[model samples]
Target: MTIKVLVADDHAAVRAGIVLILDGAADLEVVGEAADGEQAVAMARELRPDVVVMDIRMPRLDGISATRELAGVTDVLILTTFDIDEYVFGALRAGAAGFLLKNTDADGLVGAVRLVARGDGMISPGVTRKLISAFAAQPAREPSTRDLSVLTAREQEVLACIARGLSNAEIAGELDMAEATTKTHVSRVLGKLGLKSRVQAAIFYSESG
Candidate 1:
């Protein structure tokens, strides 16, 4: 399947450049572009791209807020110039599937888009320390651990994998289960927990752990 992507950045040149690189790939297409955070959200809802290449800084709104607003609607891969941008953690909390440096090479950029499109997550190694420190400094919230006992063992396992950022196929592989069975388990877990997406599941585990 061709992976549709939405490129959002304030700089016209940057957005055009991303499109040039992505459009060259046989398996990828730039379905849309947005010049700011608000436009990003609107275009995302309108086009429903598989992935969004988002910037950290933009006028009218910021990437973190846009990421929060669009979480679960589409995968967000943050493209930022700063290695240690403060907004990276917020984007993660908002369910961004990947984080990348603006200076990342063309191949890395394409790989990130494709990975996230396939329901995987990634971050550049250079910025891993900053992300770790940011996650560590924040006081973890106390999630409602009591009510989760109602879930069956299989459901619990699915939830754990979701929290770890695994796609349905990945979970199936890890559990020696079929892909269809994995979907049923994930749906069951979501229904039981009253959660909308894996991002929430991940946050719950992060706090509970």
Candidate 2:
């Protein structure tokens, strides 16, 4: 199935480049483009694309706020030049499905869009360590109040792999299970934890420690 996408960035040149890259892929199509956060949200609601490739800083709403508005409406993939902890954490907290740096190659960009479209998640490899560290520095939650005992052993293992930023295929390989099974475990883990995405699952795992 062709994955429809909406590209949103204030820079016309950068937005064009992303559109070009995404349109080059056989399974991906650029349905629309937005020049600012407000426009992004408006276009997103109208077009209802599978994914929205968003920039963090825009004139009106900012990507985080737009992301917050679009939550449950469509998945958002934040592609921006900024890799600061504030943007990273803010984007994830705003319900972005993926966060990637603008420096990402064409293939990486396409892969991130596809991943988010399919309900998986991605974070730029360069910022993954920083993201983990930021999460770790947050105050730990009380173990008794925030129990993970509800997850099965396999589900807990899946959550751990997610916290380590492993893809479903990687988690499957690590656990000696099929990729489909890994996806199942991931879904179960998120459902049991009452989390929205793998990003949140990772945060929960980090704060649990």
Which candidate has the top score in TM-score?
A: 1
Report each candidate's C-alpha RMSD, comma-separated, in the order given.
2.9, 2.8
Mind giving the per-residue lDDT tens digits that candidate 2 earns over 150-205? 98878888999998878888898999999888888887887788776789888788
- How do the residues 82-169 of candidate 1 rate in per-residue lDDT, one tens digit apiece? 7656676677767787889888999999998987786667788876777667668998676666757879988888888988778888
Candidate 2 lDDT trough over 10 residues, lowest sum: 138-147
Cα-based lDDT for every prediction: 0.84, 0.89
| Per-prediction TM-score | 0.82, 0.82
